[model samples]
Target: MDTPLSGSGNLPPKPGNRPPLSLSGLDFKLLRVFKAVVEAGGFSAAQNELNVGLAAISKQISDLEIRLGMRLCTRGREGFCLTEEGKLVYQASIDLFASVDSFRDRLSSAQNELTGDLNIGVIDNTFQDPNSPLIAALRVLHDEAPKVRLRLHASPLDDIERGIVEGRLIVGVVPVYQRREEFDYFDLYQETSNAYCAMGHPLFDVDEHEIDVDVLRGCEVVNHRYALHGDKANFVTLDGQSATASQVEAVAMLVMTGRFIGFLPEHFAAHLVRDGVLRALRPDLINIRTNLNMILRHNAPRSPLVKAFATALGVDLKAL
Candidate 1:
C-alpha cells in the first residue's frame, strides 16, 4: 500500500531514514535559481531574469523539492504561491547569503590591501553643493584602494537609510532630519536653503525689504517633502497656499512656472540666480540651515573597505 502524506502535503518517508543533505556547488546553483524564481514571482516571468528556459527552471525547482523532501511551492492554473516550508526556506536562504557576504568581507579585510566593493548611497542634489567634499573623498578612495570597486546610488534620505540597514549599501550621505537608533551619524557639513522665485514671479523683482512674512502670506509656496524647518525657519510654514515636491529638482521646476515660490540649496540655485532665472527672496531672513551627515549601520561589521572610505570622508570611526 502507498504510505500516508505529511501535514505539509509532502509524500511519506522513503523506506528507512535518509541521510542528512550535504550542500554542494549544485545545491548553491539550485538555491540561486530558486531565489530568482521566487523574486520574479513565477517560472514564466523568471525566464528573462534567470536567462534559462521555462522547462529547465521547472525541472530545477522539482529537483530542489525532491532533494529537500518537501513541496516548496504551488504553481499552475492556481498561480505561484509559497508553502509554509518554502517561506521558512526563503528566509533562511537570505540569512545564509548575508553570512557568506559577511565572510567575504571579513576575508578581504584580513588581507594587506583593500580589495572589495564599497557601495555608497547619497541623497539627490548634494553634488550641487559648493561645500560638498564628496569628490575629494572619492579621489581619496581611488588613490588609496585602486583595486576596490566603487558603486554609487543616489536616492532620497529615507531610502538611503533603508539601503544601509538592509546591507545593500555600505555608507550614506544625507541631511539629518530625524535620527534613528539603528544608525551612527557623523557630521559632514552644513547646507542652507532660501526662498526663491523665478523670473516671471511677482516677487522676482521686489525689494528684499518688501518680501516679508505678511507679503509672502498672499503667494503660493512649494513644500519640499524632506525639508524640516526649525523655530526661526518659518518662511514656508506661515504660507498662503501650499504645494509639495519630493526632490529639489522638482521644487526648482515648480518655482520656474511663474506661479509657485520654493526653497532650494544656495549652491543649487546659484547658477539659476546668475542666469537671471531665479532670485532669493531674502537670504538674511528667509533661510534654513541643516547639517549634512554620513551615516552607517550602528552594529554592522566595519570591513577594511568601509574603514578606508570613512577615513577618506574624515569620519573618525574610533571616536564614535
Candidate 2:
C-alpha cells in the first residue's frame, strides 16, 4: 500500500496511484500510538506514556505495518530498530503533524485568539547582557496572550537564520551584519565587543597606548565561523594561528587558552576581564560594534499574537 501520509476523507479515482482506503476508515489513534513508540524507543518503553499493555502496543504496530504494507521496525531481545523505510515514514509523519499544528494555529489566529505554540529562536548569550530586552518582550507577550505556549531556543547564528527561513521559528534574535531579503529585521540594540588577550599572551602585557592594528596583526587571532564571509575586513586578524568557533563561549575559551586572541561580547567577557585573566586589547580601535536585530520571515503570516509580540519588542528599541 502506498499510503498518502496526509489524507482527506475520499479516495482517488485511480486506486493504483494511492491507497484504496480513505482516511475516514483509518484511526488516527493508531498513528499516534506509532509515534509514541518511535519517540519512546520501543513498545515496552512506551507502555507508560501510551497507557496500554505490551501485547496491544505490539499488535497496533503490526497492524500499522500491515496497513502500510511495509516493515517499519525490528523488535527482539536485541531491542527495537527502525528499518530504512521507517526513517522516511517517521520524518513524513513529523512534517504532516507539524502542518496540522500550523493549520490549527492559523484557525486560532483567524478567531482573533492567541493560542498555540510560538517558537522563538535566538543566538547564544543574549541573556547575559543586562540591557537585553528579550525578557521584557516575553513578559509583555505573556500578559497579552496568556494561553500562548512560547518555546525559546538558543542556537548558532546559522541555525537561527535557518529556523526563521524554514518557518519553524516565528522570530529570531541575532546580530545582523549580513541581511537576507527573505527576512525583515528590526534593530533591537547595539552591543560592543573588543579583542582580548589571555594573561600569558604577548599582547596581554603590552601598554594600551602602544596597542595598534599592527600589534594585533602580529599575533594569532580567532574568528567566528560566519565572520570570514562579508565584513571580513572589519575584523582584526593575526597571521598563522587563526581558529574558528560557532559560539561566544567557545570563542572566549579559545582566547582563555592564551593560544589565540579573540573578540567577545563585552557582557559575556566582563567577569573574566575584571578577574585580570584577560585584557581588552585597545578598546579605542578594536571595539566591534554589532547591531543585534529581531528578525522574522518576510512571508510569514502576521498573526495577532505575532504582531503583538513585534509591537512589544519594538516599543523600547524602535526596531520594527
Candidate 3:
C-alpha cells in the first residue's frame, strides 16, 4: 500500500479513505419536498401538494441540494426544468418511495381492521349517473371501515393506468384498453356515447342518414390522446390541426365551439340536446359502448380497505 504521506509533507490524508455519507441524518421531510418539487416540475407548482408556502419549499429543496451536493433543477423566468442530476435522483426517489409504501402495506397486513388511505381514480362526468353507484359504494365503505380514508381522483385514462401501476393510485375505474398480466380487472358497467355536432356546425343541417362516415372524414372533431384507435372509426378522424383535450369538460367545450363535432356521453349531453346546443348525428351508426373496468394490481397483497371498497362497489352496483 502507498504510504499516507506526500513529498514535503509529514503526512497526507488518503483521497479515498473517507467514511461513506450516512443518510440517517437526512430529514425525510426535506426529501419528501424534493420529491414533490421534482414531480410537480418546480417548487411553486408543488406548493399545494406539499401544503407549504413557496419560500418553505424552496428552502427545503435548497437544503436537499446542499445535503446531496448536487444541483437538481433550474427555476426562473425560463420556467422549470430538471437538470441531468435531477433526472437520476427523481428515478431513485421513485424506487425509494415505492419501497416505503410496500413496507407500510406489509405493516398494514398485520392488523385485522382496515386503516389507511385508499386512492381511487375514475373518469370524469360519470358521477352524475345514478347507476354509477360510486356514491353508494363509498357510503358503504365509510360505514364499514370508518378509519379508512377514501380518496378519489377524477383523472384521464393515462393518469389512471400509470398511477395504479406506480402505486400512487390503488384502484382505477376506466375503460380497459388491453389486459395486463399484472393487473386484476373487474367489469363494472358500460356507458354509450354518440357523435354530436353543435347547432352552428355544418352537419347540424345534414340529414341523419346522409351523415355517413365519408362525410365525417371531412369534418373537424375534438380528439383525445387516450381515445382508442378502434374508436377512431366512430369519430371521423380528420386531417389537419389536431385538437386534443385531456379532460372531458375541455372536450365538451371544444365540441360546443360549433366548429367541431365530437362524441360525448349521452347522459351528459342530454341537457345540451334539450337546450338545442348540440344534436346527435347517426346515433345508430356512430354509437360506441364503453365498458368501465375496476383495475388493481394482482401481485400485491391488497389492503383490507381495497377489498372492502371493492366488495361495497360490487354490492352497490348489483343493487343498481
Best candidate, TM-score-wise?
Answer: 3
Candidate 3: lDDT over CA atoms?
0.75
Q: Judged by lDDT against the true structure, how good is candidate 1?
A: 0.81
Candidate 1 C-alpha lDDT tens digits along 1-320? 11111123434345477887798777777787887798678999999978989988887887777667778899999999999988887766756666776677777767767766687999998897878878899999999789888889899877888778766678999998878999998888999988889988999888887889767657788878777665333555444445788898999999999898888999899999999999988788778888998898997777778888888988898877
Candidate 2: residue 79 lDDT (0-100): 94
Per-residue CA lDDT of model 3 for 154-244, tens digit only, reads 8888878887777667888887667778778888787787888897899988877788888888888787556564776645864563688
Better-scoring candidate (TM-score), 1 or 2: 1
Off by over 4 Å in 1: 1-23, 26-94, 231-233, 238-241
TM-score (C-alpha, index-matched) for candidate 3: 0.78
Ranking by TM-score: 3, 1, 2
Alpha-carbon RMSD of each model: 6.3, 6.6, 7.6
Write the number of the candidate with greater lDDT, choosing between 1 and 3: 1
Q: State each model's CA lDDT, in order.
A: 0.81, 0.76, 0.75
Candidate with better lDDT, 2 vs 3 = 2
Per-residue lDDT of model 2, residues 2-86, tens digit only: 2443333322233356545444435466677787798678999999978888988877777676666667889998999999988
Q: Give the true-structure RMSD of model 2.
A: 6.6
Least well predicted 10-residue stretch by lDDT in candidate 2: 5-14
Estimate TM-scores for all models: 0.76, 0.73, 0.78
